[model samples]
Target: MSRAQIEPGGCLILAGTPIGDFRDASPALRETLAEADIIAAEDTRVLRTLLQRLGVTTSARSVSYFEGNEASRTTGLMEEMLAGARVVVVTDAGMPSVSDPGYRLVAAAIEGGIRVTSVPGPSAVLTALTISGLPVNRFCFEGFLPRKAGERRRRLGALTAETRTMVFFEAPHRLADFLTDAAEIFGVDRRCAVCREITKPNEEVVRGGLGDLVSWATDHARGEITVVVQGAPARVVDIDGALARVRELVADGVRFSAAVAQVATATGMRRKDLYEQALAKREEHEDG
Candidate 1:
């Protein structure tokens, strides 16, 4: 195709590749691959395999664009587009920029006055969410948790009050630790679904409470794993009632710290705030 056939200022095409099943490749994806002047891929080897599987031959020059090199490679790709090349960006799976390398290129392209478009295709997030048996009306996607145990716990602790269902991508090896921390922070009884190898022949989804899932992951959690956890049950926060509960626990010989933890978990209040309030109430009673 000639320059006139491409967009006036050239175009940046973000194309979604199949998450697992190769048959899920769209015709638009094939066309974009075959006709583009340059193709930026997360993994060029994966892209070549995809092209071979789809029986599509492309004359387009392929370049590696991934997390490590994205910063340096984006400018060159943008320049190519500025020179009137139809540039297509694809990741190993799913949509580019969702949790992939295309975001930087898209931002740079826009800044450089190039037109950007997407050819939507399979998404592991949406696919897993729809079949997770959790409430889909409202949800949040947490791509991956921090590798460190302390950091992961802090992250999950911050979301303890989130009422919308949560989706998270996790590695197979860390699945047990992830679930264990999630159970401790979110509650052992919270419902969740562990969707593994989505859309592939051996796809499996294990549904249960966080505690049960933790036990199951000990031996069987393998492959690409997506965890969908049901949100915290909605509870009306009543400061007065929570303070009263704290006082009762304290009177029954519970330590101040222990009392605060119990009340916070029961009332969905921040433990630190509850502890301060309980301390103040104790001081007032002593003064009286």
Candidate 2:
């Protein structure tokens, strides 16, 4: 277990690759690439290109470890690590486990008593958030949204009242649709920042309300996209306001019960309390 000895059970290294500019790569990454006995990469071809760009040459065995094959490949990678081989996991970009492979291998490695370490590098999430001109004091990373419109809207609706800033990775082609849905659910006036092709030449960051960004995406927006959205504005919990929202939805053709459920969910209020209050209000209005 000494530093000089690659014990019968070695360690797993989770290396972070640059999200855009290769120059942002750390020296630790180079050392890991050169020293790892086995390199599990999301894409071997892309790894080769990165190695070439960094002028790094290694004798380690390179294997594909992307989403499509990660499950099947975990066993073999774990076996190598348990057999005293230094295994390094790298995704196409950013850290391996964040919206990428390496989770399975890391978990298996730990379960097998193997050590796991990371060589941190540039992250699209952090990169976009810091430069997004949005509040970063408290934020959450929502990797990607459902591709289907209905499902995406439902998922977004669930976060309509989220107060913490949110970050999301999105495909260039889906940028417009994603923004459009976000605008409708989060509101047209909600502030957001769309960062594209970060760190590389032609990088662009569009900051504005959801409505303005949607209009911009209609004509521009390409490359890797990371969106930072301002959290919902803070509001005091008001029973009257909650009831009003329920009534509005009910007027929009939603069933009274369903509207109560939706408003309760969005406002984090007790559904029973909202239902009771709404019912009383309706009865009073009808009597008056």
Best by lDDT: 1
Worst 10 residues of 2 by lDDT: 1-10
**Per-residue lDDT of 221 in model 2:** 80
- Residue 217 error, candidate 1, Å: 1.0
TM-score of 2: 0.90
lDDT tens readout by residue for model 2, 1-288: 322134445788889999989999888888779877899999999999999999888999999999899889999888887788889889999999998888888889878988887888899999999999888899999999899999988888878778999999999889999999999999999999999999989999999999988878978988888999999887567888998988899889989998888887788788898999999999998999
- The superposed Cα distance between candidate 2 and the true structure at residue 140, in angstroms, equals 0.8
Extract clashing residue pairs from model 1: none
lDDT of 1 by residue, 59-152 (tens): 9999999999999998898888888888999999999998788998888888988899888999889999999999999999989989999989
Stretches of candidate 2 off by over 4 Å are 1-8, 247-258, 275-288
